[model samples]
Target: MSAAIFHNPLLNNGPDPWIVKQSDGFYYMMVTAGRHLALRRSRTITGLADEEPKVIWAPSSPGPYSHNLWAPELHEIDGTKYIYYTANDGGGDDTRRVCVLQLSGTDPMQDEWIFKGAVNAEHPGLDGTVLPHKGELYFFYSGYGHFPDYGSAIYAARMANPWTLVGPNVLITAPTADWEKQGGMAINEGPAFLRRFGRIFLIFSASATWSDDYCLGLTSISESADLLDASAWDKHPGPVFAQYPEHGVYAPGHNSFTISPDGQEDWIVYHAYDYSEVDQKRSESRPRSTRVQRFGWTDKGMPDFAKPMALDTPLNRPSGEV
Candidate 1:
């Protein structure tokens, strides 16, 4: 039971981080590294530091996605590989949109990634992620609302295929709580899905990332209910994960989850901002790092996230891994 306990900030300056266990038996990580897209692969999450990031794709021509790339996520659907990300040219929100890249080769690093165009949200949007439940594929993402203060809100629709949108964008969660409004933006974005106990929980980050108050909130829908119906969702009252300023961990949101190698334990991977830093402007300049912690379920089968663990304390790795 005595496994190695690694430090927090697993990879410094890594924000909007996402890790997926693919068919290759390796963990693939994607994060916002400024303007271009990059990927890191490792047998274990702790081993990620041993490997240098492989720069997979950078736009060669100048256009809508030529600059400011953020929140890149990778997925393999059917037999093809796809990547979802947000970017824009210098022309402001008009150019900012959710775009995708498709790969022909197995290895994303060595493959030729073809531009697949934007998700066609009809409004300014970002953080596009896909989830397939039952027999339908749904595309979930964050979009700019009509109100200026509604910097972003989570929305989704059934997808006809990987890159094609089928239904109208249904608004899932808008920032109605005061905790969600920070740094002038009432935001709810960075959605990740966890399906269990006959329910689908859409866990997402809320508030501005630039602010330390940035955290996570949860909304769920019954598996038997109509997922496309906005009225079917049950919104949690507050954030499931938030700042632990006493432990020097702040803005602990924007998360993704994966099961253990033996499929016995569930682990959640996320990035957290430093708490001691006072300068909000310069604080964001410091790189956010990726961390993982074990999470469990309540008696009622809801996710028991508890509290954000202390930063400096060492914790054991997930159940069964070398």
Candidate 2:
């Protein structure tokens, strides 16, 4: 018997890749759709691109939440499913904020998607994600502000509900290191949550997305600690996963975690560029493609995301892939 094999760059032009496996035994994925929200479902991670993405939702009017859509993340809280994504008018970065959409039925493809409105972060931000901890909902986002430099930073605020944010936005992390402050501006965004062995980890991206230096960073706190307490969180000094230029992989960030089909392995889905797109002058226009690879945990309980694999490498498909 032979193992199934797949290649990297699963979908060209796919950026900010996000994948979440539901109880239906299918993987649902969404990326930066630019003008609307869409989802792709597949039985195996690598099979996602084979299915035509279903446009589940789009703005009904030309308003604040009508344009520049990016990074749609699906989450189920309580019993309702919601999609949190970044959007804005044509007004640019300061106008960008997180918006929500609710599913009217179990089937995201068949159900109606209703606009729930913009989250009240009180400050403009992007790449919003939810963390339901200790029976409460907390929202994590990249709030636009000055951390001594004009750019984005990570913030956490308790959500009054799935679509509304309440209380003060607690600063979780900001770009300070040279690596994080590359490509003209500092940034720390695209937050995702992971739990393992009594620790809750927050994985995020740093450095400007257009820069070859863009990469992933991680922070964590004890499962029992006060999640909102800034002091309780420990930030890893360097990027946990970064570019492998020698492998023709660059700017690998905006990642999401999901388990292999049979629940036997952990996989990371993200987007990056090929060697040709390494030119910083034209990097912003270069299309990023979604890629996935399985990862492991360390003896210290930290996720070990090795360097991004080369674009042409043929690797065995995730364990139990259908």
Candidate 3:
């Protein structure tokens, strides 16, 4: 039989999409569910939308981590599953911080998710992600800091464990470029690690997510370099991925990377608006749906995300789909 086809906007109401294909030969996905963390599993990359999302974790009462849950990412370390996400105490943006959850039991859907508490307690931020290298763990997130302007900037700290951040947090990248300061905010958030050709690439979202100008930025450091050292990273001057107005795609940001089912292809899962319908009433809570498309690596050892595709475009499914 011929391989099945897929389209953009895999889900109509998913933002900050995070997906991981595990050794069990299944793809698990998690996105921003506002008040709780949810999980979906499927055999194919495009099948995640068809799976019923299981509420793996939800707050029992209003507290520090009881409101504004966003960007939930699932990662496994030493045979245990942990989720790193953003949450707040139902206050303003300053209360937003990265929190973690630990899993008990074999399956995520049937397991109990225990709160592990906030990371980097002194520093309030959002969008926490993990990068493991050479038997060490590094945690990256968008922390509330001033880069000559009061807004969020990318920060990194060494992880003592899945939920604890050790040492001082180092500033990685800031919103200095003109493109990074759009929609009345200067921002550099959503840091995701992509490793290729023995180098670690830091891909992050820039500008305000609610703005049509929201896009993706890039930076990198050699695998052997000290990840916590801010000087060791080389920041890209321009966005590596941005809106494709001709294709009717807008504000693509907060991305995660996963391999094809057969582990032969690289795919990017991100969230974007279907069209430019900006209004005075717009906010981050606006429905930004999830999308996925295969990306290619450059001969010079870099990622080429190309341009965002239109929602109606029919594309071949990921290679080796079951």
Candidate 4:
């Protein structure tokens, strides 16, 4: 089995794209469609864009989950598929909160997805995601106690179940470094987990997405230790993955992990803007596109994302995929 090497910008444009390869040997993916929730079905990762995405859910009225939906993560827990996303009215940040939508069946594309309500602990935030690690369910997201100065930082809390967070949120990381304070704003968001190389690392997007300086950061935790304690995490001092202007890729952030078809190789799928989109970002009319690349590890057991390659460059296919 061999897989093809796909180019950058897997799709035309979307925010917070995620793909889940299920036991049925198909990939179920969904992106923030703004006005509605649509999912694409593909047998191969490269086939995602060409598939006719199905619209599974949408906001019925002008209330809580009405507009500004951002960073929705789809997961299967206890044989049920669920989606976690940030939503708010057209009002402002104060109204922003994380919400969940649960599917009636195992398959996300065919079953009816019902609104599970807000998952945040009565706060303002977005990009909510949950994972079951070491027999415990934990929710990780970017949020704040107060806006304007509270800014957006990474937070983690224990969850009693998929649709609920059970305790006070712990601040994991915020925009403290100079690189994180780009475009006159400091933000740490889009937290994604990678449990490998003898540690559990939190890989999140840093800085404002609109800025060319937007990049990725890394924080690690011991697999045997308590994840609820904020002090147990170790954030890397700098960006793990960032823009490569010479390659024409900028603002590479908001990433998710997957494996090659044979399940022997690790891959990363993320959204990044090209140099051409930087100017258009002023009005935000143009959108960032998702890209896929194979990443490796250093001798130190850390992930080496290398540089963001140009879209025109050719890359080798993932090993053992066909």
Return the TM-score for candidate 3, rounded to 2 decimals: 0.96
The TM-score between candidate 4 and the true structure equals 0.94
* Model 2 C-alpha lDDT per residue in residues 158-221, reported as the tens digit of each score: 9888998788999988898888988888999999889999999999999988888899999999
Clashes of each: 1, 0, 0, 5
- Poorest lDDT segment (10 consecutive residues) of candidate 2: 275-284
- Candidate 2: deviation at residue 215, Å? 0.6
Model 2 regions more than 4 Å off: 1-3, 276-285
Tens digits of lDDT, candidate 3, 196-314 = 88889999999998789899999999988998889999999999999888998889999999998878999999999876846543455558999999999888889999999999888
lDDT of 1 by residue, 43-86 (tens): 88767766889888888988878888989998988868899999
Error of 1 at 220 (Å): 0.3
Q: Write the per-residue lDDT of candidate 4 for residues 246-309, one digit (tens) a residue.
A: 9988888888887777787777888887764346444455678888888988898888899988
Q: How far off is residue 16 in model 4, in Å?
A: 1.8
Worst 10 residues of 4 by lDDT: 276-285
Model 1 residue 251 lDDT score? 82
Worst 10 residues of 1 by lDDT: 275-284
- How many clashing residue pairs, candidate 3? 0
